[model samples]
Target: MANMSMTKTPIAEQDPKVRARNFKEVTLGYTAEQAVEEAKRCLNCKHRPCMSGCPVSVRIPEFIAQVAEGNFEEAYKIIKDTNALPAVCGRVCPQENQCEGKCVRGIKGEPVGIGRLERFCADYMADKPMNIEKPEPNGHKVAVVGAGPSSLTAAGDLAKLGYDVTVYEAFHTAGGVLMYGIPEFRLPKSIVQHEIDNLTAMGVKIMTNMVIGKVLSIDELIEMGNEAIFIGSGAGLPRFMGIEGEGLVGVYSANEYLTRINLMKAYLEDYDTPIMKSENVAVVGGGNVAMDAARSAMRLGAKKVYVVYRRSMDELPARKEEVHHAQEEGIEFLVLNNPVRIIGDENGRVCAMECVKMELGEPDASGRRRPVEIKGSEFTLEIDTAIMSIGTSPNPLIRSTTPGLSANDHGCLIVDENESTTKEGVYAGGDAVTGAATVILAMGAGKRAAAAIDKYIKSK
Candidate 1:
């Protein structure tokens, strides 16, 4: 029987005060009992709208039924049938906008804690290793660019099809954004490593520090005997406001800051990575990246961290859970404000920032209310460090080097309906095609492109 409870079981977590000062994970995963209880809440809707909401189309009811039956290992198998990174996706994917959003239980009250249960199943399997069978080699080879979620998903899928899959990552680490972009406190690197290890166990070869464009171009890969290539090189080019003092010594982009702390091991004292010890830091923007920056700044010894968003709280594009966590961790939100310029001292170091108050006006192209500047409402804020978290676009390295690969005006790769690019035998997906997006969406793109690549290769 369904739990029939309006309220959901609360997952344990670190204390806000303690977590704010440390780099440890904030939300401790659900216990086995808690996971079982949460699974019982799934109504097992005949329509399975929750599965439809998922980008990778995970069989929701089937997995939930296994969980409800106390067969977590079976549930993990069901999830793995479609999703490659359940643990990471369970933590970071915007469930509010996706699977959980279409939950039947959520129609009247709280949704079943799907993410929590998924995490439980994954963690359970991790603790007790399960035997997995490797597919026989199909004698075909495919090259995947970038070891991020998208490329990793495609690599896993192709490897399962008995193809020789190799993932090329620019960074020294395997996981691209999963290693450099996302914080360990949000999605632990160990978990990501475990997932990557599973992929490697399946005969998927991962070569780190392999910059496709510079080290080996697309032409070189084909000549090297790779059958097809899938570009999942994500958007890593950080966008910054063209304002005075932006080049100040204490300024940093969210990507650079997170990379240093997450990938470079700057958060630890033993590591030699240099990171700013800002006393008063301000992160500009309101999305999840902005929250990560603000929270990271706090852990990096910032006495005060401020989020300067141009829109109101309701207009915030970040996950509601993230925003709430930020608030609980003592992050001050200065909403309805936009930065105009950063003020610096004579030594070219940031000292303060000038901002203008904004009000909601007409809806913009993004369907969100346009923030209009409130004239004569400019003010100054005292800040030692300024971190820009506005947004990012795809890096032009591969696109610029690869011939016949067309990109849009914004530098995003243009692909056909089959995720095939202008160049034959090549396909692109994820943030490389669409700007910064969710991990699930990127994985979906990879899955689609993998099918297209397989079909394209067979036709040859």
Candidate 2:
């Protein structure tokens, strides 16, 4: 009999009060029994609308059915066939808006715990190691710039096709944003390393601290016997509101803040990285990045963290799960307000934030209700630190350096439907082409580009 419960099985988590004070992972994954119970909730719709919503098109029903029968290992393999980073995606992917959003069971009740079940299978496989055979090299050298999700996916796929793949990363370590952008409490660094390790086991060569446009040019890579090159150098340029007091000492872009806390290990007592110890912090934005900044501030010992958003709760662009987690962690929401200026102290550090009240108006370009400032409704909140988490554009290093490369008005790389750039023998995708986007979307771009590169090489 089908379980008709309106609510899905609840995954255990750390107490909000306790977790807010520590950097440990919050959600404890489901047990074997719980995984089976949750898997049973899937009605196994014949149409499989859930698969359509996924960027990489994971086999949803097949994997869930395997889990329901307790074939955990088989489930992991099914997910792995399409997704390169199931563990990371299982945790960070916005399934509520993607796969689970189109679930048939979600029509009346909560959707089957798809993310949780996926997490279970991934975690299960990690606990028990698997042996992988190295693919015989195809003698064609492929150079992949940026050791991020997109490049990693491209490299993995190319390697599987027997191509001699070389991944060049600008940072000292690989994993790009996965290494520096996301916090460990959300997606652990260990999991990321494990995924990278798998690529190495498959004979993928990684070169770290190698900046492509500076240290090596597209011509240099091609001259070194590389038949093709893939660019996935993600968007690292941070955007800020052109307001006064933004250059204050305590003010930081969410990129820098997250990089320090997550990448530099400032959260660890042993690390001597300098970070502002603020009593109160204000994160200015409404997206998932803003929520991450606010929640990270709380974990870093800020007594109070406020999210200052221009739009109302209904229009919040962040994933609902993230918004809920932020609320549980005691983050104060200053909705329907936008920051006008940052008030700084004598030391040139942030002290307060001046904001104006906002009212929802007619739908704008993005289609959500636009926020209109109310005159004479300016207010001020006392804060010691400020973080701007608006958004980001692609870094201009590669575009400015490459002669024939083309980019749009936003500075993001201009690519065809097949992820090919204007430059011959060069392709680009992920944040370099789409600005900031989800991990799964980036992976899909990489996979598609790999196929196109393969076809191009074969024709030659």
Candidate 3:
């Protein structure tokens, strides 16, 4: 029976001005007492629809029941059986679009705060001493490219099944997008490092600064004694609005901006090399990445920040919670507007931007109402920096060098449902296959590919 008197507890966050000036965790997590109360909101339903909503099918009701009884360790055990990176998932995942969104309680009142409870359980588990049992050597080696969520999931799973796994990453460190693409405030790098450490402790070999196509092609991997290959290399190329003056000094692609700050540690001035610093900045797009970039820019000391999206507020693709957080942190939302061009000053630095008003029209191919430009509604806004968060694509380095690997017209690799490429034993997934997509979805693709590669190697 549900506690009719108790509703879900809303998680609190940091204050606007203080958070804007520094890079620190914004959302304070639920305490043990609050977590138990939140867990009690679960009806402990029989059908378990929430489980179906999760890509990894976490045991939602079981975990909730355990938490409701103050059995945090038991709850963690159930979630970890299905997910390798529960803590990370609990924080950044779009539970509204996934697990929590399907809660039966949500039909009447607020959904059981599944994400918060999940975080609680996972965090509790992280605090405890872990004695994970490692699988004995299966006498075969598998190579995984890219150490993002996808590669990490595949590598962890493969290692558990006793296959020797070596993960090759392009960056100086592992946890590709998690460490660099996501801000430290949303998901602390320590949590990401902890997850990677779990894999490494399980005997998964990680080689950093090893770009597969550049360091060694896919064919060479097979020749070098790899039984099978999983290319979880995510989409790394940034897209722009194709507006003029994008090459101006103060203009940055969200990819570069995030990479410079998150990966290079530009926030810790003495640790990282120099990167461009701005005062007034505008970020173009509505996705979570755009919000992340815009918020990060403010923390990097920008006086004012703007989120410029072509569509209306209802059409924003970022998680509702994140969008709300951005607004709460004082990020200006300039909806129903589209940038036409970036204006530059005499020194070739970004000075301002020219934009036009847009109106919602009939639904387009993506099912969202298309935005139409309004004639004579053009205007210009002054700003020191502009960042394009429009979208991203697969990098062409591997596709161009790896023979027999066919990519779609957009250069995203075409793979089977099992994530097998045209090239034998060379499996690919994540954004590298689907272009820009949700992290969980990319991880789902990686999980499927890992299973397929496991089967392929065993068959041989």
Candidate 4:
């Protein structure tokens, strides 16, 4: 640890009870002083195993050195060289499992705060003028489907290469799941919009309200002057546990429920859109999305919010910080319980949900212990609302229209190491390729696909 300065740990965030009542960002960003101090904790190892966990491979040590020296511009340059969306990554990336996971300092003490430093540098440069390089025009046009993280990264990279990229987003706004799927408390809409604006500044054309497979097919993209097409349309289909009373009123897929509130701004007092209400709400799942939905429901004025999961607290898959915040906001946790049926009232409105106690069985193929219900341990609890956050797969629209676009049994599009689809000049990646995954993994897919598209266009 020679020549390395120790950094102070970040202080605890604001009380969740007070913060959850509003739409403000949950984790306040690090101050300039705090960021620089945290930067010093890096040992600047020669091998730099931390970079190995990074998807896009930002120069971890170099950036830390710059921040340690108080050279903010140099630090940002090191990050922006590869990562196109640092601001978003800083806030949402799972550093604990990724970059920080491989840190040498983590052998004994805490690891260097690479995620926080990346976020700080990105935000610092965001206020100043953008200085990203614009590659010489390649004179080829590419059609990018979806505006989620994958497509955003691909489009940004393709735009820099001067490919005349146009992102087609089905939603009114440019961000796909980022705009609708994620709640404002986790990722602020303004920050996402600002990042999109940066891409536009780089000459990336974005077309909103344009559903690709429906409005135009894969064939149309090539026919309409686009030499190559990149499908990054993320998993839009929500999975529901097919049980009784699923059709009951007030039951919602987490996607539909969050979109109704986040993208549509249904919670705004003067907003035109409206959302259903209930005194007690139940969100089924143990992931971060479940936490987001339950917390959001509480903000919408629900008297009580409950997280229903089949696993124990230790096995819950949500981020530790998110779990801590949810508890602070007064959200209740119903662990080791599985929903059997969603019961409804005489009017077909959701009134209660039947649950069964579960015991952890042997590990399943997915590696997590499977939940086996204890027979005769069923119980019913009255509830006004139920939200399902199991998971989602890519929509069938693209696969339906684009012949020869190979997909597996799960309906997720199949792509190779380079992200080229079965089609000659088409490439697909992100959640569309792998099922729902982290933002960084999807971003890596996008970066890889951009090169594939560029090479295909050159060959043509």
Candidate 5:
């Protein structure tokens, strides 16, 4: 029988006070009983509206039904059939805006804890061996650029179709943004590595530190007998406000800051990487990256960390859960405030920032209310370090090196609806084609490109 509870089951989490000082994961995931109860909240709606919102189209109701029955391994299999990274998606994917957002139960009360249940099932089967049979090789060699969500997803799907797949990643590590962009507290590195291991076990070959454009061009991969190439290099180039004092010693881009703490292991005492130790820090933006930067500053022992945004809380683009967590950890939000310039000390280090108050005006092209600057409302924030978390664009290395592959004015690779680039036998997806986006969306693009690539190779 379906559980008729109006509200979803709540899961356990670390205390805000304690978790703020440590780098441990914040959510403790659902216990088995909790998972079952939460899963039961699923009405098993015949229409299955929740599945429509998911990028990779995981069998939402089917998996939840299995979880309700306590058949965890079965549930895991159902999720894994479509999503290659259930564990990573469960923790990081914005369920509130996706699966859980369209849930029927959410009409009157809280939606089913789909993400929580997914996480539970993944953790339940973590130690169990997956008896997967490697498909027979099809003799078609495919090369994927960048070992990010999209590339990994494409590689996994292609391998399942018996294609010989090779993934080349620029970084020494394989997980791309999953390893270097996100902090440990949100998504553990171990979960990412385990997923990568699964792909390798399926006969997917990964070559790290293999810069596609620098080490070898796309034409070279084709010359080396690769029948098809998929680019998922992602958008790593960070955007700045181009304000004064941006070149100051203490000014850092969110990408560089996160890379230092996450990939370079600067947060660990055992690691030799150097990082800035500051008492007061300012993060400029209102997206998830801004929240991450602010919360990370707090964990790094900053006495005060402020999130400066030109928009109000409602206009903030970050996930609500992340914003709430940041508040719980004592990160201050300076909404409706825009930074105009950074002030530097005589030693060329950041000492403060100049900002102006803003008010909401008419909606802009993005449909969000445009921020209008308030006249003579200038103010200053005393911050030793400033981290710019505005946004990012795709790096131009691949486009500049590869001929016949065109990119839009925004630096995103142009692709058709099928994710096929202008260059024959070459496709691009993820952030490379769409600019900065969610991991699940990137995975969806990769999955689609895999199908397209398969058709192209078989037709040839």
Candidate 6:
């Protein structure tokens, strides 16, 4: 029987007050009964528009049908057929803009909790060992740069295809942004490790602390018997506003701040990583990264955290859930405000930030209203620390070192429709190809590159 309820089954979550203080997961996954009810809400549309919205094109309707029938294992298998990182994607992917957006139920009511159902299915099978038959080696070697969502997906796909796949990561840890950028309060490290373990189980070898452009070059990897290479290095280089006081003592980029707190485990008393303990913190940006930074600052004992954006609240680039969570945690939103410069104190530490009020103008290239600054509307925000979460670009190391690997002005690698780079037998994807983007999009690029690499290698 189709569930015609106007609202989908609600998943339980930690209280805002309680979750705001800890680094634990916010949303508790759906129970078996709840999963079934949610799955029942899926009309199982014949067109399967949800799959079209997905990057890797997971078999959505089939999985939902399996879930509805209480066949959790079968549902997992169906999703894993295309998606390599279901657990990660379920937690972090913006389903509202993708799968759930195209959901038929969303036309009249809330979408069938697709993300929540995916999370439920993943968590249900987390303890059970997957019964996977490792494919026979095809004798071709493929090197993947960066052990991020893209690289991991590419490696997993290639490994399953019987290619000798090895992923090289610059960080000491293997899970790239998953380990360093996202906070545990949203995406747990254990879940990420579990997914990586699944990939390794499929014969994907991961080498950490192996900086590709430095430790080994693309030419060197090719010479060392790597028949093909896929670069998913990701965009790690932080962008600044080129304003004053950026070099001050208490000012940090969102990348560095999140990296220290998440990757270095600074929040844990056991970890020796040093982080700034501030009374007032301002995160400059309105994107998801900005939300992560602001929320993280609150958990880190900041008395007050402000998300300072140049646009209105409606134009915030962050997920609505994230913004709501931040608000519930008492993080202030200083919308329609743009920072002009950071103010430093006598000792060269951030003490305040100078900002200008902004008003919306005509639509810009991004289709969002352009923020025009108001003259004589400059104001100052008193703060001890400032975290810039403006954006990030791909690092120039790989492009500078690897000849013929072309990149755009933003340092994003140029790739063809098939994800093949100008350098033959070499390919790039993920944030390395498209500037900073969603995890699912990066995974999609990896999946495509893996298929292309497989075809390229087999043709030789």
In model 3, how large is the Cα lDDT of residue 22?
80
| Candidate 4: residue 358 lDDT (0-100) | 95
Question: lDDT, candidate 5, residue 223?
Answer: 100
Model 5, residue 436: distance off in Å is 0.5
Q: What digit string (tens of lDDT, one per residue) describes model 1 on residues 184-208? A: 8899999999999999999999998
Clashing pairs in 4: none
In candidate 6, residue 170 scores what lDDT? 93
What's every prediction's RMSD, in angstroms? Answer: 0.8, 0.8, 1.1, 1.7, 0.8, 0.9
Clashes of 5: 0
Off by over 4 Å in 4: 1-8, 132-134
Model 4 worst lDDT window (10 residues): 1-10
All candidates: TM-score: 0.99, 0.99, 0.98, 0.96, 0.99, 0.99
Candidate 1 vs candidate 4: the lDDT winner is 1
Return the TM-score for candidate 6, rounded to 2 decimals: 0.99
For model 3, the run of ten residues with the poorest summed lDDT: 1-10
Best by lDDT: 5
lDDT of 1: 0.92
- Tens digits of per-residue lDDT, candidate 2, 130-236, equal 88889988889999999999999999999999999999999888998898998888889999999999999999999998998899988889999999999999998
Q: Comparing 2 and 4 by lDDT, which wins?
A: 2
Give the C-alpha miss distance for residue 336 in model 5, angstroms.
0.4
Model 4 lDDT tens row, 350-457? 999999999999999989898999999999878999999888888988999998898999999988899999988899989999988888899999999998888878
lDDT of each: 0.92, 0.93, 0.90, 0.88, 0.94, 0.92
User: What TM-score would you give candidate 4 relative to the actual structure?
Assistant: 0.96
Candidate 3 versus truth, CA RMSD in Å, comes to: 1.1
lDDT of 3 at 182: 95
